[model samples]
Target: IMEYKRGSTLRRGQWTAFVFLLMIVHQCVGDIRYSITEEIKRGSVVGRFSQDLGIDVKTLSTRRPRIEFEGNTRYCDINQKTGDLIVNERMDREELCGQRPSCALLFDFFLENPLELHRVTLEIQDVNDNFPTFPNEVIKLEISESAIKGERFSIDEALDTDTGVNSVQGYTLSANEHFTLSVHTSADTGKYAEIVLEHELDREKQDELSLILTAYDGGKPQKSGTVVIQVRVLDANDNVPVFTQSIYKVSVPENATLGTAVVTVSASDADEGANGELTYEFSHISIKTKNTFSLDPKSGEIKIKTMIDFEDTSSFELRVKAKDGAGQAASCKVIVDVADINDNAPVILIKSLKSPLPENSPAGTEVALIYVQDRDSESNSKVRCSIEQNTYFKLSPSIKKHISLITAVELDRETQSEYNITLIATDEGYPPLSSFQTITLIVSDVNDNQPVFDEQSYSAYVTENNKPGSSLCYVTARDRDWRQNGTVVYSLLASDVDGDPLKNLFLLDSKTGVINLAGPIDYEEQPIYELRVLAKDGAGLVSYTKVLIDITDVNDNAPVILIKTLTNPIPENVAPRALWPWR
Candidate 1:
């Protein structure tokens, strides 16, 4: 027989047994049956029974019935619900009666089976074992130098393995006076938190610093872990320098020597060290001479490197530079004044006067003086004079410092009123330089003596029958002056010596000095006539002379005649005498 246990109601170490009895006089036994009250537990066995008396017995179920019987032929019956057994035949033990009775036998057995056949159940339990970790393992952040305080920056997420309420809950940061940290939810997933910065860092004060972050969970007893963060600060340039004034002015003597200090300049910077350091330089300019100037590279002091003379150069202007070590620089202008020094000599351009002088001019006349000028400073600008050549003229000898009248000369118009003269002018410089000028003089003439005629006595003749107003001869006078001054006029001064004015009457032409008969002349009363003549200039300066005239007769009248009557008286007488004779 086999036994089994079920659920919590079954007990351990429990079993049930079955028995079979045989009857000798059995014609055909009615069906026998027995009952066992237990279900088949997992890993248990089922019992078997048979109906053939001479065949073996076997257990079977109508639901699972593919089993056979073997061994003893005696047959028995079984109950499937209770697992009980019963027999129907009896027989001897050995050869049908050899040893013992077979009808009174009992048997027991054990079974082994699979646990799956029993329908077993199991349950699992939970525990907190893992910590939270960052997804990236290492994180980095960047920011500009211009970022101000309270500026914010983003943080990466942390991870954990525990589920639900036991996972990563919140985050915290190490205490930092300069900075603050916070946790924020991820917009993409509510499963992660982001670490954020709430404060700013300054590079000028602190270049770099470190921070710590911790992640916590919602377990009954909270669990957490920390991560390290590094922050770096950057730099910027912002400071500048300035100069106090834009330009500087100074004055120095023109005769200053090389390396002579003229002036100094000053500047300031608000920065320190290399950023604020400064330097200086100069510019090129044109001057009267080969001289130069320079500025100190470090001190910014101005100085002259060559000699200065007012005669060569009078003034100058200088351009200068000022710079810092940072390569940033500025420029300024400087004015330099050079004082005066005496150095130049005087020069004379031209001198001389040439013109005619009237005759008989006075002895103290001023003919001409010299002209000159000097180019120099102060007392050296003064000039003086003298006459190197003074034969034809004389110099006064007292004139000085006056270029126009260095020497005075007198002119004489008598013997030789004309002269060619020369004069010289000199300056007061160390090696006094001199110059010369030349002039010329001329004489003029005046009127004085009266003119005279060449003859004192003269003669001429005319016929007694000639007409009046007829030309005879001309007379002339001479003067040294040319033209009108040298010509003379003539006039009759007196009558003839015959006492009969008509006998010597004559007329004289004033322009030609000619004589002619005034009336008809008779030789019986005056045979000759004489007269006095005068010659003069138009101004009436006079000279006198005499002229003689003579006359001749001609036959022109007839004689008267008377007659006598003698013949007639003779005839008459003869006749009377003859008559007296005849009577």
Candidate 2:
């Protein structure tokens, strides 16, 4: 045997020989060549050293050594030439110590050394495990009547075990017209929803409402769940009351006693309960009386609380108010007329007056009469008259009961034309009412006057050729009576005052006092004459007077023929002697 240094020397020689053998083995395994087909299936592993050394690589031939990996770990790469596996770095030695490494560990080593290992093939399997849930299972919301359509209300939440689109995908509402929902995020940490009210709510019409909310997730198909929502409404006041009539009128008896009911008024309110209730009261009055009238608190019945006398009061005016329970009120006026009752007596203004005894007395004079008035029935109407001790005036008992007369004093125009006196009138009563009146008497002037002519005697002149109906001297008279009574008439009582009765010149105008010729006057037969005249009044009183008439001659009378004709001797031949004598 070669002398072997069994201690240090033998150790060195053994190291050298081991190194030499190790080099050879390294050279064979390290330089090993192998190729994975381009069409190699995932998770397929083969031993590269066994194929290169042409030896039964039993240890490495089973498949590629697998490394167990956990969450977020994977096989990063694999060596195609040597069939070396690469995996993530976090794999522990216990995972590698297993007789058959887990594929997860192989993925980890491949991922860890991805530069040395070029490729990795992993096949992760599916599992059915997680149930979908909501981030917040329930939601709450509020809305207003003023809210517009499609306004957003609030947001909701959901959760899911799966990720990506496999988590909560969308949301839905049962009452879509009233509300709506939409997904806010991509299932982040679970799922969430944004809810909105699709339509406005009117609290005045509806008080409360209900809604249903649902959330769905993306799975193989789809999955969904539901939530309930409750909503409440509030109230507001916005109404007014109306009346039936604008005004009311009533009539009541004047003698109606106190507390008598007159009439009732009313109004209406459309609201409910207290808001619609109405009441009545008096607002004003035309006549004020101390507690004389009142109204029913709720019914508005006008009543008389005190005595009403038509003798003193005729009508009453009242203003009434109708109020709702809401404190808003309206006012109206009512006229209450008090009917009349004839309970008063007539009174006299004048009691007595003096009597008048004149025929032509002026009007408005109290003469022989009494002023009487009745306060009772006509059967009780009685009046009497009497005159005090006076010789000139007397009262007649058997004649008119209230009349007096002028008896003893004879009315004479020469003595006195008027008389003013007094008389007394008395009625037949328990306390006979007596009154006195003054009477005025006037005596009228009778036709006892005689007409007096202007002169006792007068004269007039006339021409021989005076024509008939020619004016002569005028004769007039006077009387005491005025106008028609005092007027004097002219007439031929016996003969004309100028004594020309045969001369036909005795005509006169009674009213004008003018004398005129009744016919032609002949101066040869009655050159001068004496006449008589008469004057009278309508009362037939007459007076007489005389007048003298004198007639004068004029040349106008044709020359009473000393010679009937005269002739001119020389001019006879020229003009045939101017004229023939009258035959």
Scored by CA lDDT, what does every candidate get? 0.48, 0.50
**Per-residue C-alpha lDDT of model 1 across residues 120-141, encoded as one tens digit per residue:** 1100111234466664444433
lDDT of 2 by residue, 1-583 (tens): 0111111110111000000111111000111122222223445453332343342444433433333222234433344444444232332322322111212211111111111111122322222123454433443333446556665544434444344455556777775456676656531123455556676778777756777767677767676666666555433223445657666777787668777888777777776776567777654222243156888877778788887765345556666666555444556667777764433222222212332234333432223322233332222234444556666555432111112243554444535666665665454444555556555655566666688877888888888777778888988788875456577887665543345444356676777867788877778666776766678787788898887778887766565648665564444355754654444
Q: For this target, which candidate reaches the highest lDDT against the unseen true structure?
A: 2
Clashes of each: 11, 45
> Cα lDDT for residue 38, model 1?
20
User: 81, model 1: CA deviation in Å?
Assistant: 99
Steric clash count of candidate 2: 45
RMSD of every candidate to native, in Å, equals 70.7, 61.2
Top-TM-score structure, candidate number? 1
